[model samples]
Target: MFNVPAITWTLTAVLLLSGSYHFLQATKSHQLTDRVNNILHALMNILMAAMLWNLVPSTMLAQIAVLAGAALWFVIQAVARPEFKMLCAGSQGRLKCVYHSLSMAGAAVMVAMMGLATTGHAPAGALPMAHAHHSMTPAAPSTAAATLGHSPGLAIVLTLLFGAAAVVFILLVLRFGAAKTSHRHGTASGRSARTAHGLEAIGAAVMALMFATMLA
Candidate 1:
């Protein structure tokens, strides 16, 4: 759990820089997609950071503020660039925004959940999983069971969802290898964008594993 928080901070820092780059490039190039992407990612980073750090006013309303802001930015982007097909990938641009939107919400909710667990507000079922206090022997079978026994349903659901997403992104990275430029981006810019997508896939896969490990 603690390690995940550290990784989250590192990832958010990188995204902060990446989002700023898009925003700055958009300002210079006057590219509609870049502008929209900037806003979308900016909100994403903010919401993610807010949730991870357990910032003040940590209520659903604040979470909605961040998510609603991202959704509104998305709407504006779609309206501004009706032909904006690719959010961050080359050929497979389907449901990119939807994935991002859901991720934002998840980040916020995870923050709240973690906060609850930390404050001892979590339900009784979560206590064993949280403290691992069910046994004294490290090698006890009961200990192993306790690690995963409380959240079988949620573990299965999240594991499958994230596992599939990881597989899809990995295939996309492979497919993007010899792929032609779907958009009119220049050679350097196009390569950079595809590389970013590959990185995104890697990040998603790793995050999925983290969640699975925690639940398992």
Candidate 2:
């Protein structure tokens, strides 16, 4: 009977739709690589949404729905496109795939942990506020208590996974730049690179903000 925070849920939905827009653009472009990237991007957004949603004190059913939806999307993409599967098997693609896979796994663990915490299945030591009421607690300790009391493990794991994803994404972008460099130099290449760079920056910023908020 847990409910999702309205602000976080709204932001999650917005990010999800933004990813969906990218997929739609890829479909219109009719390029196989672009389409595959867009689909994978969409999957990442969905995974993110599910992760954030799981942080809320929600029921196991909601958590299952989110994880199952992400798994189903990944499975469908893997089965429906041989090229995409091949990309995932490649070195660079594997890096990106592994990052996302770890993200999904971390999200699942977080959801399970949240469920356990809510249902009193977690260890008593896992509770954040257990010993904060003592008279000898330092000011720094109290500050830490205020900030870290809520699921610090989940926040740390999520941040690490997201950072890994961003690093892999940057590497992929560099690979794309190197490939484009060998081709005929043109204004179109510059324009496209600029656009891609802007999008990547925006995505990174949003993710950073999300991670910061989780810590808060």
Candidate 3:
């Protein structure tokens, strides 16, 4: 969760939009794998946005489980043999699956971290994933120490990883956009691809920022 309400609200809106777009794409997709992929993206985004506001606290563990399972699914797709035509076949497709696997795993880690952080503070009779007050103050020395103890070196590592992912996606967005521009009469498919990359870039950047805040 962010210390700043503005940042939190802005990310919430962006996540909602991204989630909705993915759900829409899922509905339109003809391929079963593509539809499943889009639905997973939609669920992940919506759940992440809900996490920011500590909504549906009882389901946090379930959310983490779902994300971890989704990550495994993507990994399976990535490593499947070429003979498995229904899975990711070519090198590029496999690489994309690998990236998605990493991202889903990262998201699972984030939710788990947040759940642990708040567990001790929740009232009796509530589950470990119960909600707590969202503190806007900078993390005190004691709180930081506790986080460091609970998370060790994980936060900074995720921050760097997501930051790198953001840069890569941003580059993809630029490259795709440039290709469309140069083609003059670029296909609708090209524009849609560029837009998808742009959304990916935004999501990566937001995740990176969120991890950085955990470090702070």
Best by TM-score: 3
The alpha-carbon root-mean-square deviation between model 1 and the true structure, to one decimal in Å, is 9.6
Residue-level lDDT of model 2, residues 123-161, one tens digit each, is 234345435644455344435434333566667666665
Supply candidate 3's per-residue lDDT for 207: 84
Model 2, runs deviating above 4 Å: 1-14, 25-87, 109-149, 167-208
Residue 137 C-alpha lDDT in model 2: 51
lDDT of 2 at 115: 53
Distance (Å) between predicted and true CA of 190, model 3? Answer: 1.3
Which candidate achieves the best lDDT against the true structure? 3
The lowest-lDDT stretch of 10 consecutive residues in candidate 1 is 85-94
Candidate 2 TM-score versus the reference = 0.46
Regarding TM-score, does 1 or 3 come out ahead?
3
Q: What does candidate 1's lDDT look like per residue over 65-117, in tens digits? A: 66666665544433444355544333334356556655554444444444444
Q: Candidate 3 lDDT, tens digit per residue, 66-143?
A: 999999999999999888898898998898899889889988877767765766332233322232323543334336
